[model samples]
Target chain A: MWSATDPRFGFWLPLALLCLATGFWLTDRKDSRKRLASVTLFASLALIVFFGANTRGGDTSETALLAVLLHMLGPVALMAIGSLIATFSGPTPVGPLPRGLRPLGFSMAIGGLIWIGLMLIEEPPDAIANGIGETIWGAWVEVFLSILILVATLAGAFCIMMGDERHKEAFTLTILTISAGLMFFEIMHNGSDGLEATGWYQIHWQQMVFLIGGLLGIILAFIAFIALVYMAERRAPDPDVVAPLTEEEKSVVDAVLRLNLELEEVEE
Target chain B: MSEKKDAWWGPIALLMLLIAFSMNLFVWQLSGGVEFSSIIDRMVTGFSLAFGITSFALLFVSLGAVHKHMRWQEQILGLFGCAYLGIKCYGWVGNGFDSISEDAVILLAGLTAMLAAVGLVFGLLLALVTGREHIPDLLLEMDSTDGDVAVELED
Candidate 1:
């Protein structure tokens, strides 16, 4: 009953195809299969752009496209970039990040948090169309920020507990955590013009339930997988017995050992 | 001892924060008149949905990746588990299928998958960068052989 022209179809089908294509492209062993995946990926992307631009200016489709782009670029991208920079530039830099980049990373992370605040307080993308509603977006932000805040708080606490001169790092984390917590509280009690307080609260409750459930699921799956591996290993048969080395084999081994010893002596 | 005493405050601070948040939630619930049963129902639904999806994905992926190395018994068990998980997921999601529009579900699933993929990529990159040196050692540990087994002959 659905047509390609339907906005929902236009948006969702291509997105699903894109995801499938990407997964296949990543995992496929054959070059031909990879080529097929690549073609699918490009086609799906083209379809999305075509459908998005097919509508006239100010239409729901166009608005939806713009909103989706904004959501991707605004908070999601910014947070990822910020976190990467912060991790590499922190006091205990994770990788080979330069110590000098610390300030820049710190600033970028703060900027990301500020952008999130602006999105929540001033300019929420509530006018999304094509069946993408505010509830989903709100629930996402709730879950994302809640996880960030909780993890940061716990990390900060642990850092402080180490008693190893990580106070400055802990302080920074605490500040970020508190700022995020404040933002969450603000949204919870005095919801912005885009969504009512009760609606936001409901979304938060549902998302919290989902998050907890997901965590539990991850733990259970991990345990189950480990058990399976353990059982399989236990049931594995012993190696087949083999004959001892022949004269030729022994000679070959002696030659290799003598060569290694000569090399070691020369090095010494 | 002084340092240890100082570290005690850190956990206490975390505990206080937890208590404060709990109290705030309790107050909100009291004011909001939200039913406890509804919360329980949602939690159960969430658990079933997440558990089923995660187990299925994990088992299916592992089976595919190591199919050649796995024994026939293991493969059969994994396939059976995957089927069971798939059925459970369908049952849970199907119960509320009508409530959620197909478009919304697709969109949510797509977004969640994208986010998870991105997170995984980032985590892997960080791990690669931080733990590059240990990788060769790990491989060697796996590949290293134990001493030769000795069989005694009956006289």
Candidate 2:
């Protein structure tokens, strides 16, 4: 019997929901920003639904149904989010994703789901060996954290340099495309580790996941680079036909010219 | 073009790799249950410290360019960044006012300010590195020139 008073279960159910909401909200939408920004507001709304269901239900079955639904929907939602980001990055009407990125995003989402399933199966509450399990899990966390921080810092550098909307969107898409799987793995791994703080999984699984994820990110970027090269070659603009500036730009340039006193204005 | 390419990437990539390696040490140090005394002793001569400082300096440089390009947004954010750092420094470096309520107010304000500083700086830094900031050349014929992407989009 899972007690309502038990801190572990009490803590987890809400946390899972929070992670879901955060994932949903953080997704860089092409049309609009995340509508629900306040955690308290979302938490209150979540509580209303949970309590509403709780009052009208077979408690155990209802809880189990939700758990299953959440786990199943998690990876799918991640894929959808990544695809949305991809649409923003890739050229519209022509292609929704840069050639290699579609497969890469799919792989990440599926790989994350697989890892989560394996981890859940391997980690049970009444585990016989806990120490060895913790050791491996801890190592997995340490390595993952190291890589995550390094990658984020470098990305921060790139984000600082690229101010244009299209380029910013490209970077955002690149991150989501490459990392949707790893981020899923992160969420799952932490959840399992927190559940009992004990999980005897093969350490190779962690290393293999990390390797596959890093390689996929690299491959996606490489493909995008090639796509850019091919795009330039295919759609070469005429050497003589320079684009005319818009009225706004002409005025801005004129303002600069006037400020510099390089060009005197003639009577209209 | 090749020389320019080499100059742009050579030092930056090497520095990033070095920073990445040092960050591993940072994670190791911050993580659970360790011999604190010996680790603190090694902290004096650790490569991680130097690497961390270098990264911070580079981050500042990146943010400074962002600040320059960011225009009015920079001034708005910088005022808040300075305030947060000021309050945090007061707490960290010295004992401030006697009232806990006042301290709490500063803490809350500090947190918000810190978020603004971090989020804005990181986003701006990346923007500046990737995008071209407008620099008008008065002597050049404006009709002939267009804004070029700083790191050419055409590979």
In the range A1-268, model 1's lDDT, one tens digit per residue, is 8654565666656755665565456554753555667787788777767776665323443334445455746555555665566566544433657657645655655676687678776655445421444555565566556655666666666666666566666676677668867877777778765776777676656655655555565567667667777788889888899999999999999999999999999999
Off-target runs (Cα >4 Å) in candidate 2 are A1-81, A84-91, A95-142, A159-268, B31-155
Q: Give candidate 1 regions above 4 Å deviation.
A: A1-72, A86-101, A126-132, A259-268, B1-27, B72-83, B86-96, B99-155
lDDT of 2 by residue, A134-243 (tens): 32333333333334334444554444433344455345434542443344344333534344222312222222232333234334333433444455445554558778
For residues B1-155, write the lDDT of model 1, one tens digit per residue: 68768767767677658944773484366348567776666565555555555555554445334434456466447635854774466456547444333223422433453463245234323422332222246555564346665889999
Residue A259 miss distance in model 2 (angstroms): 71
Cα shift from native, residue A105, model 1 (Å): 1.8
The per-model DockQ list reads 0.12, 0.02
lDDT of 2 at A198: 21
Chain B TM-score for all candidates, comma-separated: 0.44, 0.25
